[model samples]
Structure formats: structure tokens, C-alpha cells
Target: MISAKHKLLLGVAMASLLIACSPADTPAAGGRPAPAVKVSTLATEVVQKRVQALGTLLAQESIDISSNVTEKITALHFDDGDSVTKGQLLVTLQQDEEAAQLSSARADLAEQERELARLEGLLASQSAAQTEYDQRQTAKLRAQSKIAEIQALLAERTIRAPFSGVIGLRQLSPGALVSPGTSITTLDDLSVMRLDFQLPSLSIKAIAPGQRIVAHSDALNDDFDATISAVASRVNPIDRSITARALIKNPDQKLKPGMLMLVSITTSEYDAIMAPESALQSVQLQHYLWIMNADQKAERRQVELGIRKPGFVEIRSGVSVGEQLIYEGFASLQAGSTVAPQEG
Candidate 1:
């Protein structure tokens, strides 16, 4: 809508703005200042090759304590969660019937024994028949067998701990009728914890008893040191992994059974060149790093990486020790870009 002269003035103003914004048209008084960047020198160090796996903490020994016979509990020797020793009586059931039976059997056994003794004396004196003496002896043996069986039944009326452990909550109170195989309580030997984990079968060559492994538990807020106690004899068909178990001492009783643990196992060790993680750039699937060449220019190099730690990453190849790496200002760099080294 404007006149041709006005349009020509507008075009001139746009041309001036473009020239002011252009880097080429701006400064040539002393050439461009070098872009400064933080740098680090690659260094070689020994590092452990670790294999990570999830694991579980378990009691060294654990069992569910239950009575073998159904009977009314007459007495409870220990409270819930009591620490007990091996053979310590935990519960006693009503055993009046068993005791009566045992007493009767003992009396019968005594009578039979005396009768057999009399028959043997008579047989030695030729006063009793051989068949009769043999019969008496067999009668005594049967009576003895009856007494033995009754003794076993009476012993079952009292339940004792099979091993030293801490007992869990008691399910039955005094006077409660407990049936055979009913829930009673749990016992756990927690002085030492067992760590169970699975590892790939391909790493079987490196796994062995006595190998050191480290474990961490969130519940304890501490770390535990353990040693490999066992390794699976065969690989699992479904997962293609092998089960392993380690023994960790738990003197403070902080680690408990069924706790999930983060475990680290050392599979190998080697020396590798490491560089600051900040220096690395990921373009698509490849990792690239900028290195300062002798001419103070950035050279992008693709590298193979291994294990990564806090602020550093392993450089398996494509970079060597004594090389200067650009650790910062990576966004402003490219292949053959000029850079000024800044101390880090």
C-alpha cells in the first residue's frame, strides 16, 4: 500500500540489522577470543570388575516348631520371642493318660521279667519244659517292647527345641488344644545370615566358595561383608543362571531373614583408563568425547566404554592416558572447533 520510496527505506533498515547480527560482520579488531572449557587428563587406575545381583537374607538355621501329637497344652515353658538353647523345653501337653499307660506297662514288664526268671531257673533244674521256658521268655520280650513304645509316646507330650534359636510369637496358649501339625511358632538362628542370589551361568568360572561379596540392606542402614558359602551344581534351565549362597556374620542381629539385599560380587579386576563423565557425549547410540589436539582444536573421538563410577567412566579404547579431555562446555564444541584449556 505504501509508495516505492518508503518500501526502499524499509529494505535498507533490514539489511543493516542483518549485518549487525552476523558474527562475520561484527568484530575483527583483535580476532575472536578463544572459547574456554574445563579439561581433565585421562588416567589409568586399577578397578574391580563387578557383577551385580539381587539377593535375599536368610537365617542360618530356621524351623517351625510344632507338637507331634494332638493334646491340650498344660504348660508353656518360654514366652514369645524367647531365646532358647537346644533341648530346652518349650511346651508341655496334658500327659496324664500317657503317664498312666506307661506305669501300667512298666508293672506288666516287671511281672513278666520275674516270671521269665523263674521259668529259666526251673528249666535249668529240669523242672520246666523247654517249650514252656521259651514261651515265658517271649512273653517278657513282648512286655519290654510295650514299655518302650509307651515311653516314646510319653516323651512326645513335651516339645523341646531342636537347636538354639530365637523363637517367634507363640500361636497356642496354655490350655489350648493343639492338633498334630498345627502352627506353633518359628525358630531362627540369626547369629549369622545366609545370603542367596543368582548369577549367570557364564560366570560360573569365577564363582567359588570363600570368594568375597558385599551386601547392603536398607533396613539395617549398614553394609555387610560375606563370603561365598555354596554355588549351584547345575545351571537352571529356565533362567540359565546358577544359585549362590553366602554366609554373613550378624553379631548385632540387625540383619534379619527374608530381607532383600543388594549384592555386589567381584568377577574380575583390571587396570583401565578413566575420564571425567562430563567429557562424554552421546549422539544416538554412539559415545563421543572431545580431545584437545596440539593445535588447540577439538577432535571428536568415538570410544568404547566399560564400567562407570561416580564422576568417571572407564575408557576401554579410542582414548589413552596422558590425553587432555574437555570436561565441560561440550555443547559449544564440534569436530575441529578451537578451544582454550581451563584448569579443573
Candidate 2:
């Protein structure tokens, strides 16, 4: 069934097909060109372990300003939100009656002194009896005591700032009657802010007096530096946490009492091996990395992870310093595949 002419043509066609399928220049599998990849040399980085907590700010000194005596307000020296110095006069209540009594007492004391002097002169001349001179002396003492009592009564009507601080809103106007236990306003010393927070009992070792802390106020949109002032010796039984206090310098008086803020404390710090996040690959729950071995070939390694930073992750184990890992372009890589590493 075969013709010589047909057989010759078929042979030629077969030879052309073989030439197209296989060429002498076709590279062998073992000689395949290595893939180009970005690699990073692992190194140790000082890692900081920090803990966060919500804290409340309180003034160093705070008190409710109140009146101790029932009296009509004569003058209010401070307005709402006024800064006052310690011992500064803040209020003057009606003291007309007390002033009159004080004046009368002073006049009486002066008269008593004159009488005592006259008695001394009389005694020197033997014209006065000892009993009579003693009576004059007792009268002088009573007058002095009366004056002291009047002065004390007048002091109750006058109000003064007990400490340097910012005064709160006024509760009573001039001419209004105020009595004992009646709250007049509030006063707070803002030179330093007390930050209160609680930490777990286990973290007690990480915190101590004089330790540094940082606070962030979302309301003020600012950060503040603080130093630990006190740590609770007893842990709360209900929560197993201990309270902590930090002092924050606030000479600017920007921080207010009862404000909520975010606080951070460095629990510990140490050097640890860090791996670039880009080179890390995860499967299920385990993480792995594409490492470049000494032979310039890709090696798949399972690694243990710790804290994660912005662009790097802490390598707890399965990695060491000075090892090279593929930083990028490893999506199509296979174990044992040759790699042409460019430093990243």
C-alpha cells in the first residue's frame, strides 16, 4: 500500500517535526537558570516588651472649696477658673458686727492697761492694796482674752486660698448667705498630674518606683512623660491586680483631673533575632520562611514567632543571626530551587 514517493515525503515531514520538538540549545532541567530574589541578612535587634493600660489623670491636690460659717458674702475676689496663690484672699464675708466688737475690745484692753499702770504706780507709793492691784491685773488678762475671741470670730468670716491652684466655677454670688458644709466651688493644683492605673500581680516585678512611663491623651492629642511614684504592696483580691501611680509634670496645666488616658510601660527589653515580615510565609497555623542556604538554594524552614513589630517579627526559635532569607519574589519558589540573591 505504500508508494516510494509518499514514503519519502512522510520521512521528510517526520524529520522536521523532531527538529522542532527538540533542539540542541534546549537547557536541561538540572541546568535551569536560578530565580532572582531579594534576600535579607538576619540580625539581632533590641526588642522592647511593653504593656498597655487605661489610666485616669488626677490633680496632685484637689479639694472642694466650702464655707465654715454662716455669713453673707461681701466680696468674691476670684471669678470662674481663676488662678490663685496660697494664702491669697478669695472671699470677704460681712463682718460689720465683728468689726465693731473687735474695736470695742481693743478700746477696753487699752483702758485696762492704763488702769494696771495706775495700780503699779499706786502700789509703788503704798497707796493701793495688793488685792486691789491683783484685781486690776485679772481685768487686764480678761480683756486680752476677749480680744482674742473676737479676732477668731472675724477670721471665720474671711476666706482665703489654702494652696496655689486653679479655682473652679463660682457657686454663690456676692450677698448670698453661705453656711457650714456649703460647697462654694472647687480648687485643684495642676502643676503635676497623678496618673492611676492597675496592673496584674504577675507584672509587679516589671514595675517599680522611678520607672519611666508614657501616657497618651486622646482628648488633648498629646503625649506626656511620667515617672512611677508608687506601686501597691497588696494586690486586689477581686481582680488580682495592683494599683500604680505615676507623676506627670504638667506645668502647662493642660491635663485635667478625671481624664482617661492610655499608658504604656516597658516591661522588659533584650536583643533578639528579627525576620522581615515579607519573607515570612504562613500555612494553616504554622509560619515558615524561605531561607537561602550556603549553596545558594532555597530552603523551607518552619519558625517559631513572638512579638510582631511594624515590618519585622521576633523570631523566637528556628532562626539565627547572620542567616540569609528571601525578602521578596519568592511566591513561585520551591524547596531546593537555586536562587540569585540580591541584598535587600
What are the lDDT scores of the predictions, listed in order? 0.87, 0.90
**Residue 344 in candidate 2 has what lDDT?**
60
Regions of candidate 2 where Cα sits further than 4 Å from its true position: 1-36, 342-344
Off by over 4 Å in 1: 1-30, 112-139, 293-297, 333-340
How do the residues 184-292 of candidate 1 rate in per-residue lDDT, one tens digit apiece? 8899999999999998988888779999889988787777899999998889999899999999998878888999998888888899998878778998889998888
Q: In candidate 2, what are the lDDT values of residues 1-344, reduced to their tens digit?
A: 99999999999999998886673434323446678899888898899999888999999999888788899999999989999999999889899999999999999989989988998999999999999889878988999999999999888888889999999998989999999888888899999999999988888888999999999999999989999999988999999999999999998899999999899999889999888787889999999988899998888889999998899899898877898978798998999887888756
User: Which of the numbered candidates is closest to the native, going by highest lDDT?
Assistant: 2
Worst 10 residues of 2 by lDDT: 23-32
